[model samples]
Target: MADELKLLSTWFSPFGSRVKLALHLKGLSYEYVEEEDLMNKSQLLLESNPVHKKVPVLFHRGKALCESMVIVDYIEEAFADAGPPLLPSDPYERAVARFWVAFIETKLVEPWFKMLDGTRARAEMADGVKQMLAAVATLEGALAQCAKGRPFFGGDGVGYVDVALGGLLVWVRASEVLLGGVKFIDAARTPLLAAWADRLAALDAAKAALPDFGRVIKHAMMRRGAAAAALAQSN
Candidate 1:
């Protein structure tokens, strides 16, 4: 069953990367269909994810799952007895793991949208930066507290929690260029987070699933440049 999984994702989306990492971690082979034009989204994407009309949709045996985290959860459940378990068996710890995922999406990813979309006003960008900083600081503190004695977020191994938070680090690192020369995972300010990122990147799954940061950055720059040119033409 795992052999027949199919993933629909955009190259630049951190959300998409999360599911890819999960699949790689489980040693699953599936079709990876990249969405080239977001504007003219494929019928599969719209049909698979009717609600969100978004990418990172996973198709398994003709069943579809939307939302990156939801897809990761599905992957975890599908291969639970076979691969490295994503969710801890303990219910209490599973809840904690889920909390961080929610925190990253609602608290961090949301602000990142504003920061990336150059259409945002100056004040909005400032507010977004402020919010992103606050969220990052909170995540840093929480990770430090959690890593008191161990390495990964799941004590000794990379689990759902680690994949949930750590998957975004690469994208965040790439987007540092957008933040006016501020890097997100500086060892000095975010030592634990930085180290954790290095550890995740070292993993075979993480390495395989690592997005092409350069290409994504180039795409972002092109978008920004086109937008700026349009604005200048309007003026």
Candidate 2:
């Protein structure tokens, strides 16, 4: 029987983009339902992910899966026979990939968003940015160990870790622009990660899954302005 798949997503969400990239990499066909307003979520989304009420909810044959990375893992297992493997075949290697994916999703993402939102004071924001960069540097070291001579963290092709981080690279670039040309990932500081970001952005799956860079920058600029206004009012 053919799989009946539906994805609840938002275009600007990096989490949603992770699921999209995973689906693309697995060559899976799924109906995409965009949640236009996250605040006023659809009944489908609320029912699908009642706990989190978040985007990137995947419905497979009427069973809904919440959380972006969890959905990606489910897609990999469900469509294991269809396309290139998103995870390594070896058990140890697969565990390593899973670890890094978790690390990226949990450790790096929050600080990056905080930095982008400008919610912290200047000193605290600087510290948060430093912590975020330190996390990226750690991942850069991991990439160096795992990538060998290959272009991606998964060695030759995009893998679980790549999907986890690649989706956010667009926002990182946009945030950099919004921060007055501050370069977060550069050759001088995080060369491996900087280069990996470029490679990931150029992938066909990434190109298809990622939203328009211009739109991302415009949205980020508006957020930056709003954040600045809020900060000023608070002072």
Candidate 3:
């Protein structure tokens, strides 16, 4: 086989999972190549995504696509017939879905990556958690508006926003444990989002694409522990 479609990814990368979700949802088959060491980059990955030098470089028909969301967009456009649509058919609704995807990237995703960063002080990390939680509350409201009381942000089915946020579900679950039981999406506070998580998780696509929670948590623990040690040394 010429390997028409190939995915270069790390096991626990939510970004990688996003690409996986799109592939799985579209029911597209591809070769999965795990990047063993990020520090030691593969020539293929390096050539594919020289700008970022990151995992989740998707090669389709010998053409390389970099970035997670970009890959999803590609899948949605290129393989529209492969499965159900993720973006909305209505232009306005499509715009709305894209808007939420951006929000998740900035408001939720940024702070998440910020929290427990080894270079930053613990206090700064605490601030990150606060910001992350605030984003969650905002997303709770967003889900109501976007999903229109439906189970997913995509309403009747898993759409753009669902994949955007759902990609991070495993990370969010791992983070909850890593952060000493802080509930980002609380049933009491953000009932819709809390329920949405459970519902999205139950889907076949999620089960297929989402990384193993235990593996992610184990990796996250190492990072958190290192960050904590760095903070202690700086104190």
Best by TM-score: 3
Tens-place lDDT digits, model 1, residues 179-210: 66776677888888888888888888887786
Worst 10 residues of 1 by lDDT: 226-235
User: How far does residue 220 in candidate 1 sit from its true spot (Å)?
Assistant: 1.2
lDDT for every model?
0.75, 0.78, 0.82
Candidate 3 residue runs with Cα over 4 Å from true position: 1-3, 223-235
Ranking by lDDT: 3, 2, 1
lDDT, candidate 2, equals 0.78
Q: Looking at candidate 3, what is the lDDT of residue 221? A: 74
In TM-score terms, candidate 2 sits at 0.90
Better of 1 and 2 by TM-score: 1
RMSD of each predicted structure: 4.6, 4.3, 4.2
TM-score of model 3 vs. true structure: 0.92
Candidate 2 Cα deviation (angstroms), residue 29: 1.4
* Model 3 lDDT at residue 86: 95
lDDT of 1: 0.75
lDDT of 3 by residue, 2-75 (tens): 24889888776788888888888888888998877665678987788878777688898888998889889999
